[model samples]
Target: MHGEFWQLDNKNPDAKLYYKDHCIDYNELEAQVQQAVNSLPSERCLIALVAQSTLDFVIFYLAALRQSHVVLLIDAALAENDRNELLEHYQVNLLIEGNKIHSLSDYTHQLADELCLLLSTSGSTGSPKLVKLSKANLVANCSSINQFLPIIKDDVVMTFLPLSYSFGLSILHTHLAMGANIVLQSDSPMSADFWHNFEHYKVTSFYGVPLSYQLLNRLGLEKMPLGNVRYMAQAGGKLLARDWQLLSDYTHNNNIDFFVMYGQTEATARIAYLPAEYFSRQIGFIGKEIPGVELQLLDSEGERVEQFDSQGELCVRGSNIFGGYSETLVELSYFENIPLLHTGDIAIQSPSGLYQIVGRSKRICKIAGRRINLDELQSWLDALCQFEVVCVGSEDEIVVYSEQPIEAEVIKQLATKLKCHSRLIQTIVLEAIPRLSNSKVDYHALKQ
Candidate 1:
């Protein structure tokens, strides 16, 4: 399952992974992974891994791939009940965490030899539905990303997002595939230590979600001493237009590449990227498809939409498209023969031939017989206030959860702006928004 990256003659033997002060070379890392693989019972068994961005997780992940095992990557911070439920649902044979190995089930899911990875549809909320990714899916996506970003032996990326997340895992996959090193840190991106090590290690690039960029903006990106930082990438969610412009301006002024990427777990990692050269010009665009992917927009009735600025669901057909989802061992046999992926994102093709996300297909609700886009509502609230908020609702009412205390006037303003009855709006103040390990708001927890 693991490709032949070890055979590259140009791979720098001195180039190694940076975990704090520890540096592990490729030869040593390969040996460690081999030893771990040798100790495993057999290949092709489903292994559920509670992965943290640590050396242990990296080694074991490589080992599982080397053996062609289907490794389900789960967030290390998941609750025991949620974790065990996943193990049971998938009929996983082994559970690995650091040095501990616990055999979970006697049964093994006979998956296709091509299937090498499983990722949750939802972030750390533990949605039972799992996306089955083949080695071809991984290799194709990784190669496409490398063609654009062009990672080399000298490049060093900082680890911010959890390894369980597809985007996060792609950072590991692409960098390691190209023999570039990664500087791992278990601390928050806002932490003083994260920046300390970022500068200390001369990390060339770092990836972020909207929230991470928001925090960085508040911390004064222009003020930070990041002379060695070469590029900055934003994905996982749409960064607010204002914030995106701010970051882009700073990067441009400082001669740093800013990439706005779009992707989902179903496609392994990346689908499209707004290149650095288009950062200022292509304001709200997701840019063009990555090297091997073809993108299209389809209307609700499933017909292809070719008219410019007409909104429809974004569809992608590529070698990187994954196998069908798995809820049980039997479901593992299901593979998507059609490589097409309906991304469930409502997008419009701009006149310039770039796609812009307007909303999500599932992010709408009926309120008093009128459709309301919750994401649009959230974006409206975002533009109006500095508070972190999530909007969820039923057919008749809407609940807005604010991470900080908000004035009653703010609720009334939102209701007026959204043209909804103020009485139908309810607000809840939380110390912090309930978020998954990947920094996405946990809607499941919010509903609870």
Candidate 2:
């Protein structure tokens, strides 16, 4: 089961996985995986795997991989309609959840032998599109990540994000690729038991998204005695500069490294990351591209942007870039002919040679004939106040929804900064911003 990473660990089969009170060694895990593989169908076909971070999930996923079956990883908590749509769209023949394997519709289309993994675009917005990742793509991504992070064999990681998420899946992949131990927890961070387990297991590292950091800030992470943690990472979505600075300061004072990474499902997992040494100077920058990947900014006309601080669509080229999206069984065999992926993200090249995101191309709006980026506005609001804001409206009006009330002065300041009339900006108070299951702001839901 170790494949390439566990070559020397065959004799040292110590506890490799810790879930609740049970411990599974490497030898036992391999045996269980083989047992699970024996029961899986031998024929090649696509299978839907509703993933949960459990011992069985690990075993079944590895078994399916070993059997050369393409696995479409879906969230177990997905709604039935969405689940059915995915099953029908992909023409998946097997549904593996927990101990049960239900046969679904038969798929006759020939899938590429290299295609081994399928994951929805993170924060999919209730779309049926799924990104098909090949085995080589996964291996290239893991190798590139290891080149910078240098995952230690004895590193113990505390799982928080769901395995269905790309960032979460990368955590599991990189750790396993380095022959590291994993501490699986199927509980929310809000629960007291979760922290107790974190302490009990002495987790050496942690990974989370922006929302996770906000919750940690609310809980006062500075007061918590997490001395055993060697490092922490932030990804999935952009964190406010203020919030990131807070965590960076805390981590620095405690002699722990903090990494700010940027990635997409199309690129398998990671693309660029800010090194710990330049964390302070780079502040909100996404830093340089990872090993084996090239990143550049391309203007709307397909020309590269050479001016610093000039916004353009971020583009990535690498072996990790996935083949293409699969919306139906026929598209499953489609391979990406385009060499460069134009990420919809709008970013700029800093004077220090780092990449800083400005906004998303799809999130931009023309307010009163003047282009306004909602993401940029949200970032400014995030730095100005503690409230969470989501900007949404048409070309005539810009509506801002906040978790807390906003003062008139703040609105006026925003209008002034945006070069728009005060009346054009409307503010609404909401208890919370609508978010997808993966913790990304659900703009579609917000509009509704």
Where model 2 places Cα greater than 4 Å from the true spot, the runs are 1-12, 122-126
- The true-versus-predicted C-alpha distance at residue 380 of model 2, in Å, is 1.3
**Decoy 1 TM-score against native:** 0.93
* Alpha-carbon local distance difference test for all models: 0.83, 0.82
TM-score of each candidate structure, all chains considered together = 0.93, 0.95
Instruction: Report the Cα lDDT for residue 75, model 1.
Output: 86
Residues 1-448 of candidate 2 have per-residue lDDT tens digits of 3323322245345548887777887778788888888989988878888788888788788888878888999886688887887787777889999868899977575887678888987454446788888877888888888888846777788787888888888888888767678887767677798788888888888788988888888888876648788888888888877778788888889998888899998998899999988887687788899999999999999999999999899999998899888777777776665589888999999888889998999988887688888888888887787657778868888998988888888998988898889999988887788887678887778787
- Return the top candidate by lDDT: 1
Minimum summed lDDT over a 10-residue window in model 1 is located at 1-10
C-alpha lDDT of residue 365 in model 1: 89
Displacement of residue 430 (Cα, Å) in model 2 is 1.7
